[model samples]
Target: MVNVAKAQDETTAAEANTGVAIFAGGCFWCVESDFDHVEGVRETVSGYIGGKSDNPTYKTHTANGDREAVRIVYDPSVVSYDALLRAFFRTVDPTDDGGQFCDRGHSYTTAVYALNEAQAALAEAAKADAAKVLDQPIATEVVSAPTFWPAEEYHQDFHAKNPIRYRYYRNGCGRDKQVEALWGDQARDGIGKK
Candidate 1:
């Protein structure tokens, strides 16, 4: 009953010829940073989804119950949806039962928010492929995207806007190390392998 196609169209200006992928992978800061590095991705916005409230704020989502998510706008001509899918599985613990490393909560879970039927199938296929690669069972959810409420302007590009602080926080939090440990060879080699 979830209309991902409609959500996708609303999130992305399809007439402008752009495709969007909404993903919830732990911290939005990390998620936005990851996609920012990927080629063909135009922009990544931190946000909240899969909640009961409208226009939810970070405080409301984190303090209460809501999924922390990111909205990614990209040119499909340059990067296929499959490629993004690969990156998603590689960057986060797909088998961690909704919660990502260091950040445990419904708000910090890993999820693939499908914008359409095609995206839903693609997400499932990607997860299946990842399951074959890893020993653990995949736990990443492939669900219809919820109403996205953009986070505060300060949270938009926290990494870029505050490089030193961001680096310090990231390093101190041990995110990179955990990601490497979980990903292992996949992290070193990149997430291109299917």
Candidate 2:
């Protein structure tokens, strides 16, 4: 007889081995694309967070104060959260309180949604380190994570699905140029770099 209960336990154990990290770095499409390239990242889902709504759509979430974010599922055994934090800081303009790159508004601001106290501490430490490296104030907020609402299907992997449009938008926004000016080689280490 097949051990169904044992199989179920094994599946649960496999899932427990993974961890989630959420971050808002302007346009979830861009953020998702960036983290997807990371070594230990298992999956990246574009979404909205830090808002008060049951089901937030792209249209309504921004107006509702929900920030566009990415939910990263990663293998903790393969990569540490501190490494992810370093990558996150380098990938986005953390000094801009107004917004990131050309994207302006509360929804486009950068933030790290820490899932727990440990993650929050790591994020804070990372922020301090980044500020020291850049010699400027870091505006990225490390806030407690809330329920993450996955964006519409089309928003997911928009970069891969619509490479032309994605490239155009990314270039027009001057994301890479701005990041390079801010972080130099660290910016090139991120996604959306040519």
- Models 1 onward score TM values of 0.89, 0.89
Model 1 misplacement above 4 A: 1-8, 11-15, 188-194
lDDT of 2: 0.83
| Strongest candidate by lDDT | 2
Candidate 1 lDDT over residue span 10-99, tens digit each = 444533767889889888988888888877888888988888778788778866567888888888899888889888888888888847
Clashes of each: 1, 0
Kindly report which residue stretches of model 2 are placed more than 4 angstroms away from their true locations once superposed: 1-14, 188-194
lDDT of 2 by residue, 73-144 (tens): 889998888888888898899999989999999899999887766787898899999999899999999887
